[model samples]
Target chain A: MLLLGKNTQKSVLIAGLAACLLAAPAQAEEIWVSNEKDDTISVIDVATMEVIRTLPTGERPRGIVFSHDYSVLYICASDSDTVQVMDPVSGEILHDLPSGEDPEQFVLHPDNRHLYIANEDDAITTVVDVVTRTVVAQIDVGIEPEGMAVSPDGKYVITTSETTNMAHWIDTQTQELVANTLVDSRPRHAEFTKNGTQLWVSAEIGGTLSVFDVETKAKEVTLEFAVKGVHPDRVQPVGFEFTEDEKTAFVALGPANHVAVVNADTYEVEEYILVGRRVWHMAFNADKSLLFTTNGVSGDVTVIDVASRKAIKTIKVGRFPWGAALRP
Target chain B: MFLRTVLALCLSASAATADVSVVIHYLRQDIEQPPVLSNLDPIPEDLGLRGAELALKENTTTGRFLGQTYTMEVTHVPPGGDLPAAARSALALTDLIVLDAPAEALLAVADLPEAANALIFNASAPDDSLRGADCRANLLHSLPSNAMRTDALAQFLVQRRWDDLALIAGTHPDDIAFADALHGSLTKFGLRLRSEKTWAFDADMRRTASQEVPLFTQDLRDHDILLIADEIHDFGRYIAYNTWDPRPVAGSEGLVPVTWSHVVEQWGAAQLQSRFDKLADRPMRSRDYAAWAAVRSIGEAVTRTGSGDTAALRTFLLGPDFELAGFKGRPMSYRNWNGQLRQPIPLVTDRALVAQAPLEGFLHQTSELDTLGQDRPESACTAF
Candidate 1:
């Protein structure tokens, strides 16, 4: 396996050059960014910090998630209504998984057997069996289901319905809706803590992050964003990622162009790290040394040094860069 | 495992049993409406009601998961019927009401003391006065007002550099009101009104054998576009191809400003249009879209607030946190000043979307959507 070593000093050097040039012997680990309008994925080599290649994909590719084994990648081609499986190494189409209509975003089950897809138009969560490449279940959710997350133990699959303004929970075993906790408006993304005790869902328009107790399915805390100079309407929280230690959480504030770093235990926004316009999604390197964010309107990905909490580089990509996934 | 199954079943059953009902108090005056010019398409019989029905189904689909039941009771009353009685009946049934009546009927229902606590959504009436001095505390407007529509058109015309306008208004009172709004918009945008004329065609004259249209529209001078304000749909549709100057037509027809149009296919609107078409067996009109927005707003409030209590729902709606995703590019919320829905107005031609209003560079301190209609400072709504 190719690994991008967490060399802090080397990354600091690469940050100054705007682009990294790697030796020929070093194996390249690539990060894929899905460009929604371009209908392609820009592969950036971690060793070189450059867009090595662009691979064509289905129409309006928005969300991307990798399998546990890292051999296959699933792309949510929203306009095509199919979760496409591609070989991560070769960037070749492997199979077309049967997703519900207008699948916007999805999450892979930890068990490596199933995939939970949020169909934005059909108001349902489509469960696909990975091995069989067939749809196993279709669970009814709220209108415009756009976000999906599975619990740490793979017991519950949470779908955040944007229009319905609720986080709907479904049992993984029975494929039945278990409970629904109302959040704020336009909930775009949901994430479970590493310990599985808390679930954080981001409301894009409501400008707040709602944290819920996993056991009771009740909201425990709500975090609102307020920057010193940023207006209230611009601070839309869309995507979120937790640190490996679970001590810090990074939220992608869409249109505000800032990623808010929140102290996980205290639920306080510690700092706002400015990125690009209309930031959509985020991913971390294998060693958790660096984080990358896809900025839709700016057509670039902002790479942030995890330890320093500073953006290192902004690499230009295709139009409307949406979801990002790192393979090491 | 058996115990867990039993518990899950019990939980599901209990969740499924709870019910919440919403009634669309569709009070329409039962009278023969005057026919428009033959060029325009005939209005649908279930114009506003069908959209509310589709929205009810959509709400119920999500409501089922949340263990809530939503129902719409559409009551049509005759002309000069007991509208207050109809409002009382609907209030007894459901606190949430969607109004599709005229200005007077809307005011009559809103003026009722029994409806003081009830939530009313206006889906049809587009009078600017409703959002001005006559604005009510309990009523929220879903449809765009005449000022908003005209301002939307004005912004688009400014963007296109169509400065000089020839105004032609209809004979109806509603037409005159719309024309007045157009005049306000032209002045606000600093555009030149080259000439103004009122088409004095009565309902019978609209169908006359005489060539009055050509005679009236002939010999217009120094105008970039002909702006018609035939809100009754009487003469606006015919003015497009019949104009002697061969200039473009806009306003009530041609390049019209609308809240929603079938041609709008951006920002995931195609999905909504298809969903509505499948349900209504026709393309969604602006009125239908307005009615749908009203019903969906209530659903969103109930879902977000997680309460069936009307007072709690109203608080959440009037609160700063309320927002609804109506398939537009951004989330829509209510303007607290006048209870008008703050949304981007789409300007469309007959077959394609031209552009959305509150155009680029029209800045506002709070939101760009505020530039399209009455801003907070100029608003006369003192009642909240």
Candidate 2:
């Protein structure tokens, strides 16, 4: 309660500056999306719901992800067949990492240095070390690999092949496909639970979500979605996110124009929230109170209120906006 | 037997360790394609078979993990050759046959005693009779029928609010079939046809199209769309950009209904197109996609039942349990009433995809896709 002296105030100021240095990235909080068709990334301010910056990227920029520390961003650059590392602060591309052929999707390993990328055309999962900028391994998985996910413990990496209809499990230590688990046809995205106890995969063509036990690698549950007035074929389950408590799930049903609110524990759909057309992927905000969905067909992002399960705003983005990443 | 086996597969749920081998017998007839008016893109020598090859490659991708193996044995019949004899021999090896031939030739093989147990996929013919009165229990159609194609066109046109319609039907049998189908679709969709002309000219369309097309279409009351029913690819190409009234030409020429096209780059179709281009060294056509779908249908069955026994496979195929990832932005399935693959028909030109049918508002009792082709009520087949 007492007033501080001038000497004490100067020392406190120095300590505060040191903490700010350690924290870094004190800029505006934003959500970045890779526009596939436009070959650009749209950076939208989370607070203002407006595009703050647009950075040119390689051909067909998709599957965007921020580094663990939110320092750099990695873009798939699918048509260019390379992974582009970019400085998020300056919007300058740092370098190109060899990403085999048609790297459509990828997951950065927990090591934060290695990226396991799905080379779709080559039917192999390419592991590239970001620090070294070299290919660590190219493990053969299945044909037309699209979805990539890494376990929380970094012990297992999963690659879901679109045509093969199997999720190829790669051992991070051996960099080999230790097991292959068959799922519904045309599996597109793979996601692991927060605790890494379960793995959920979305099948775009199959119109189903398959959940597997992480330990035994056994399929524990299968969730199917059917929204009224939406064609079953159009109800393609693509990308999904779990709520903060991991009790609820929001699944993006591509072309169905709806995001399904599901009870994660019961594996039942609670409600359907109508969003933009052909919703591809989504990213939650820092507080987990708001979710941003990338609508590929409509060329917009639907910001949803998590608690109410309602779309609060529509943020127009570049053409065919694909992947979403939050910079917090 | 199929139901029990599929149930076992469902119960096992984990490991499918049994090596299920499937051999698809591809029987193609080498008939002289009707002369086309365009020389820009020539038909590939290996058109339909290339699609089957690619599908086999794709099936093997899933088969490798599911303990299944798929191989294709193709036999090409020379023009005016004994197709039934060739089909009989192919059927001796395997009951799963994919036939790429004209409607009559397909019927000749389907009616054979050996084919009674065989499951044949018609990958080339667009004849509606094959899906209707002439339907066979063993023979299923992967290719869209003439009615399906025309209905897709009709849906596209109606959804775009194009009301006035005129038809230029060729005199060939295939053309007549297509014209009839289009006429039926026009009526089904409640769009009145303003005019109908039969193109019976024996002169070279290449030389006379510019000179004769205007006069040929001169007498017609100008309509919104001139649907050219040149299913054989003759004269239809000449109609576009040469119409007397400058009307848009559809049907076989401009924005045609096709099973697959290089122009379709949506819904992950670009990846498929790139793969096909790499394999065949040319753009994939409708026939190629038909064959691919046919082969993939068999693969789906084998994966589901985990066995290659044709009878069990057929039972599973005709049953409601089968769904195919058709790359058509839909989970395609066979119609039990007529054995036609229910899929979204892509209406496209050689350049770009105009739209996919079952457009937006076309509704049906069961499925919106059912509004495109001959629905369950309209199906006249008693095959099942």
Q: Which candidate is the best by TM-score?
A: 2
* True-structure Cα RMSD, model 2: 7.0
- The best candidate in terms of lDDT: 2
Query: For residues A57-114, what per-residue lDDT tens digits would candidate 2 score against the true structure?
Result: 9999888887766678999999999999999989999999988889999998867799
- The lDDT for every candidate, in the order shown, is 0.81, 0.85
**Lowest summed lDDT window (length 10), candidate 1 chain B:** B1-10
TM-score of each: 0.84, 0.94
Tens digit of per-residue lDDT, candidate 2, span B79-126? 999999999899888899999999899999999999889999999998
Could you tell me which 10 consecutive residues in candidate 2 chain B have the lowest summed lDDT? B1-10
Per residue, candidate 1 scores C-alpha lDDT tens digits across A115-159 of 888988788888889898778888777778887888767898889
In candidate 1, what are the lDDT values of residues B230-279, reduced to their tens digit?
88887676677677777888888788989999999855587788778978
